[model samples]
Target: MRRTPADVWLALPQPFLASEALAAGRTYDQLRAACHRGDLTKLAPALYAVHREWADLTPAEAHRALCRAAVSSLDQVALSHLSAAVFLGLPHPAGRLGKVSLTALRSTRTSYPDDWRRVLQADMPESHLTSHDGMQVTEGSRTVVDCFRQLRLRHALAIADAAAGRGLTTPVALQAMRQFQAGWPGVLSAERGIPLVDGLRESWLESASVAVAHELGYPLPASQVWIHAPDGELVGRVDVLWFEWGVVGEADGMAKYLGAYDDDPSPTAAGQRVLLERNRERRLEGLGFAVARWGAADLRGGGDGLARHVQEARRRARPEQIRCLWRQDLKDPLQEWVWPPPTRA
Candidate 1:
């Protein structure tokens, strides 16, 4: 009943310590040989994962794996900041994952590798800690606030919006959390950004779109607004809506359209979806709503690109031309799609 390296790797929890394998009757030489043979991939010092699992992961997943490995190796460390955001599944600005973030009480002297970034604080509130998939993580509200304090305004708002939209926290709660950290270095920035968090946003792109709109000084638009045709049929739900301005803003992601029809992946299918989207835009135009669409490019362009799109929408808007209903008389079409969807007690 001698287990092979693959069997040992499969049997142990992922991102495990070398000592665990040794304890299970696996020799140190065997572990070294497995790593040398590509059966086990060294994540950090002493932490290993099956080579196949490590190689097949997306960048985000790989980053999480590193975070998990870091958590497993460190003692009295609770994941915080961007690392906590990742664990909580909140959206964050793109950044390198070369370092893992952890928080510990100022009194605790915990040594970690150079790759670990430790944030020591005098107050280690119990309420702010929670267990996520067996790892200690800073709670969502605290994580969002920490992000707002640590990241740039745009980056922080993206995280806040994602957290709120996903029902992890609310603007009010985040604001209240900031009250205690008044003398903190980045409190003002967090205060200014908290009001921008909107829970209705369904995707990170939509949140980024809103952040860009805010940078352009545009008024906050209703999110997830329903648009109806003259015949009372649902046209679609717009990402951002400005009723008085007669403009509808869509944060377009190509992935949303592709594979939408019959799960097709060919170029022809993609072209067909594009044509259908164009026709849908035409219908919106006919109803007197100025349609403003921005894709990943505009998002990558930063605030300037978003401002340009908003200016175009403003130019095209004709409030007098609007004939479509903003709200439906029937039950909310997207009630079920709401985040933290209703649960039976």
Candidate 2:
């Protein structure tokens, strides 16, 4: 059958069984035919999917599809934790097709060929569940709770920020979820992930800046602060800027500097990208902005290390800029002065 947008929208991501096909007014042959031709993707027996490729499935759409497929097995499954996270389109790891997470209330086991996760529970707390298209799921608050419990702090925070960005959850919701979690897993997870749950009102970099500040007890610098060169050309906007100290902090997430799904045909191309970043940082420094750079490693300790680097940058810049100027010569200050760090010598 020629699948229209509406048809595709109606079809779930998982494939259906012969019985399900028959129930839906489609014969077993028709369902099998669709599967054989790649028209429908079979997630498991009686679980069928008709997705628009990975790019086509929005987080909500993916979650909805997973719900339908799981529910067809007799409401025996509900998406949970990172799996629910993926369905919600939160940017955690395993962006690709990994194990699809499934949770059930009663002690009934299910089998599937595809990667599947099963969580069985007697009671999952009403506060923890939310209705999405009339199906039950771990609420956005609870999802954030589960995120830290189930994954590393950075990954959990990344998911939390993405959810916050999408308006799926709130910092207050995170706090409430933390309160409700009673077990050791819940307690520890909430501790690690709660601070990172602030609703930062800026880009991903700004969010990182907030996390770093909270983790290190350092004051956060102004985000998206504009810095200019001598000739009036915008040298660049700093990710986080210390106005008083003439220092600029930049979080260099590899996904930003290095685009995802890299297809490096030539080794020189990678080297050239590195050279370009170096040049960009050098130019920023020339604009009277002492730059402190960081990456994924800097985000370790849930942003403690990142904040320290920012602090150090501010300390170094203080001696040079007793009076901070919005307009400073676009020349290399580091070249003119030699305030060197003293070694053991």
Candidate 3:
């Protein structure tokens, strides 16, 4: 039986190129008709995927799929910046994947589809380039550095924290990259954030909370600290821990729990999870730690609001109420060696 274009696309591996389909004896008109019929989804110009498969992915995953599909069509370009971050499996702020970013070694007048963005940069050394699963992308250190140089401070810290948290790169490596970027725009912002990067930040919201805390002159907090009850029973792991302040901060993003527990898809499961969290908080409070909880609102409201909320919690933390619970040390060895360690003159 002769197959339809949609059938042809479904039969072939997903994210296939239009040229490949044409080579397989499928007419362009048929491919267009399949798209019109909503059987195939266009990932990029001339790049298509099975509609059902594409629909199953989250926005971030879909962005990654589009980037992977678009790479074959990109000429004289290597994925860099945010695109590299995504391709390298590094963390980045959540958003639409509006365009695929590429970096070229030299100036080029080559045109790409509207969805493709080319950055003509001559400073990308060969060492910074790497190939992952047949797709060329920037190395982790270079990718994080480029991201720091391009993104705003909050988002830059997010990328750096994610990179460190994932063990993809380190502050020392990023500092070395920064040395090469002297006099470059956003270099200072990048430098300021590199040392602050912590891989223990399990989520972007946690990273953002830390960034906001720093902006408000709040002493940096230890991440993922263990809370124990007076009887030595493990209470739970708290998000941000300030030992000296005897305060703990929680960066709550509903997506964290909801996304993980969506399999149940019932109010009962969600209520149970909420109750569990509340009980955990009560247990920590029972141990004499002043707990500060902020959700996506404080994070989105900027540093001032988050700082106020955190400060209020700190104020309420009385020395009499403070406990002497020992914090488990989970510091990264890389964090101890200072960036640009002092040199005797």
Candidate 4:
């Protein structure tokens, strides 16, 4: 049977089990064969679906398919972490497929046999548990906390950003929740990841910019800022802007420039592009903004390099430089601007 676009759209970026596909009036063997022949993708054992031809599959679809498979398999596990973030309508990076993270109480031993991982939460609170679309998962707050414990700070920040953006977790509430979990790791994780959620960035670059700055004692900027032209057309916002230093920092990861070349040839064109950014930089510089460009090497490398870069930009900076940069240009005046450079001298 030909499933509707909606049905098929709901079963990607994660696998579906055979029996469930059969119940949906789709032949499992047919889909399996397509995956075997490279016509489709097998997200897990006996789970099959047509691959998305354009963009990556949606998170809801991934969760739906995984939940369906778990239910059909009669498994006790439920989606969690990045997968759960997707299910909860929180944005996450689609590339990492280390696991279709699942959480279950009392630990079950079923295995996917391919492209799946099972995570056990031995103490998942029963009251904070629920089933959605056939899979079991911890409630929003619990899921957010669990992910913070397991994933990297950036990934955790992504989950928290999504959660907070949707009002699922507020700083005050989360901070209060931390009091319930005692011990070293719990305390450390809470200390590190909580305040970051108040204003999380949409992209990994922005998140990294936030973290690195915080780590290096440089005040983090308002990420993904929107700078508009006088006519109201959006120009562009720097990835990171120090409103107090008149310094605009961007994480110029290789992907940014390389992605443009891959997406279209025009961005790499001689006069068509190189000149475009040059003009953009000139306009920003003319506004008394000093733009500092950092790449993936600096971000992924570590603190010393990034610290030096930010420090050099702040050395000898005046309030007027930042004052005009924010007030006249970006329209945001930062109050945290320290005077006398904090006297390291």
Compare the candidates by TM-score and give the number of the best one: 1
Per-residue lDDT for 17-106 in model 3, tens only? Answer: 888788888888878877888888876677888899878887678767666756666566788888888877766777675576777755
Q: Which residues of candidate 1, in runs, are more than 4 Å off?
A: 1-4, 94-96, 105-107, 110-113, 117-122, 229-233, 260-272, 328-345
Candidate 4 least-lDDT 10 residues: 321-330
Cα lDDT tens digits, model 1, 314-344, are 8987867576654522474422112222332
RMSD in angstroms, candidate 2?
9.1
- Which residue runs does candidate 3 get wrong by more than 4 Å? 1-3, 11-16, 36-56, 106-115, 229-233, 255-272, 303-305, 319-321, 330-345
Native-to-model Cα distance after best TM-score fit, residue 255 in candidate 2, in Å: 8.6
Better of 2 and 3 by lDDT: 3
lDDT of 4 by residue, 1-345 (tens): 332443453554345566766666666556755665665666555655556632264545555455545544645666666666666666555454355667665665555556456554545567656666545665667667766776766667767766776677777766665665555255577567777774445565666557666766666466665544434444456676666676767676545544544555444554444466677666666555666766545665555666667677666444454322122234554223333334321
Backbone atom clashes (below 3 Å) for every candidate: 0, 10, 1, 1
Please estimate how well model 1 matches the true structure, expressed as its whole-model Cα lDDT: 0.74
Candidate 2 lDDT tens digits, 174-195: 7777777767365686776675
**Considering summed lDDT, which 10 consecutive residues are worst modelled in model 3?**
332-341
Question: For each candidate, what is the lDDT?
Answer: 0.74, 0.60, 0.73, 0.59
Q: Please report how far candidate 1 places residue 317 from its true position, in Å.
A: 1.7
- TM-score for all models, in order of appearance: 0.82, 0.59, 0.81, 0.64
